[model samples]
Target: METRIFFNPGDSIANIHDYNEAVRQGQIFKRERHSDDLVIAKGPGDEEYAIFYAKDAVKNPGKGQKPYDVKNTL
Candidate 1:
């Protein structure tokens, strides 16, 4: 059997085109956790969400783009 984790989504930001817009518009594309390495995925309409991997998933860095530490609270 496979295990899964659910991450909640944030409020919508209407009409974003691609990665750069995601950055310019103050979206989070990077995160640091003790275990899982996180990823940012775009939906069919270019809305972004989080996909947490049990193993490392540090794949795309948005073409030499810098990382953003999106603020969060428990």
Candidate 2:
């Protein structure tokens, strides 16, 4: 049996028994998004929890191609 470990961004600990069990049983599927990796897990009462990982770092917004001013506007 291959032990697949998934990291939950919300929780620092990696060994979440419930999540591991769910994944092992194919109840939940891990999906990756453009900005971050997502762990989609099914919760009780038809509720779902999405845990995001590897969040994009905050970047400084540089000057735009065109200056923002009344004169620059055409």
Candidate 3:
């Protein structure tokens, strides 16, 4: 099964490890990859953002690897 990971800004209490752990622990919200891109819903009254990872995103997590803007094609 394909799984999708989600991270929120400033959801970490400690370092980056803790941040990821928090995400794994449900401190942040996440959902499985149901389509080409995941349509994420933000907090109440907030705008929605789509998170997507290219095929090589896992190989390269740095900039230029993932699509920052959902509307723009990667």
Candidate 4:
């Protein structure tokens, strides 16, 4: 299992709702052989999930990690 640290927990808390909506819409974008997931909403918090946006993305340095990012075409 990979660990996703909120890039900024403050922002995470502030935009969690939107994150949840994206997830609901199946808008959670994931890259191939990458651990970056795109954030596509801006709402409140959903404990079920949190995001680490691309503004300051620190890749896993290897294959298969799970954080948050942007650049969605869906």
Candidate 5:
């Protein structure tokens, strides 16, 4: 499985809602929110994507060997 991340400088809630709608409309496979700053969505294929939100910026978790941790920040 391959994973990717996307950043959107918009309301996290709205973003999540959009993903949920997509899932409902059969546009995506699944979408989930791990935290206030993290949301995960899966595509029809083997692709997984995530969206990470920070105060004024949106960040992608990016490809990593393991799940990115959002609790600890410097």
Candidate 6:
């Protein structure tokens, strides 16, 4: 079986367990913009939802690109 996870643009980001499960299943992960006008995704990786950015996703909306804490939380 395959499962996918979705998150709204500008929402608090968290690692998806599906990513690890996909790896275990030998399935390819994917990430893309649902709508270009809504948000723009960045990064050059093979993982979907690897990194996403939105204009109003931050407090200082125009402070360049915001950084995601991609590192392990624990």
- What is the per-residue lDDT of model 2 for residues 23-73, given as tens digits with 9 covering 90 to 100? 432323332222334333332222333232323211232333111111000
Give the candidate order by descending TM-score: 4, 1, 2, 5, 6, 3
User: How badly does each model clash, as a count of residue pairs?
Assistant: 0, 0, 0, 7, 0, 3
Error of 3 at 47 (Å): 3.9
Q: Give the whole-model CA lDDT for all candidates, comma-separated.
A: 0.33, 0.27, 0.29, 0.39, 0.33, 0.31
At residue 33, candidate 1 shows an lDDT of 30
lDDT of 4 at 63: 42
Which parts of model 1 have CA positions greater than 4 angstroms off? 1-10, 27-40, 44-74
Poorly placed runs, candidate 2 (over 4 Å): 1-33, 47-74
Candidate 1 positional error at 27, Å: 5.8
Q: Give the per-residue lDDT of model 6 (tens digit) for 1-74.
A: 22222334335332343444323222221223232222222222434433232333443324344433232111
TM-score of 4: 0.28
Q: Judged by TM-score, which candidate is best?
A: 4
For candidate 5, the per-residue lDDT at 6 reads 39
Candidate 1: pairs in clash: none
Q: Give the root-mean-square deviation of each candidate in angstroms.
A: 13.1, 19.0, 13.1, 9.9, 11.9, 12.1
What is the Å distance of residue 18 in model 3 from its true position? Answer: 29
lDDT per residue (tens digit) for residues 1-74 in model 5: 43343334233232233444533433222234333433444322323332334342324443332332232111
Predict model 2's lDDT versus the native.
0.27
In candidate 6, position 43 carries an lDDT of 20
For residue 19, give model 4's deviation from the true position in Å.
9.5
TM-score of 2: 0.19
* Model with the higher TM-score, candidate 5 or 6: 5
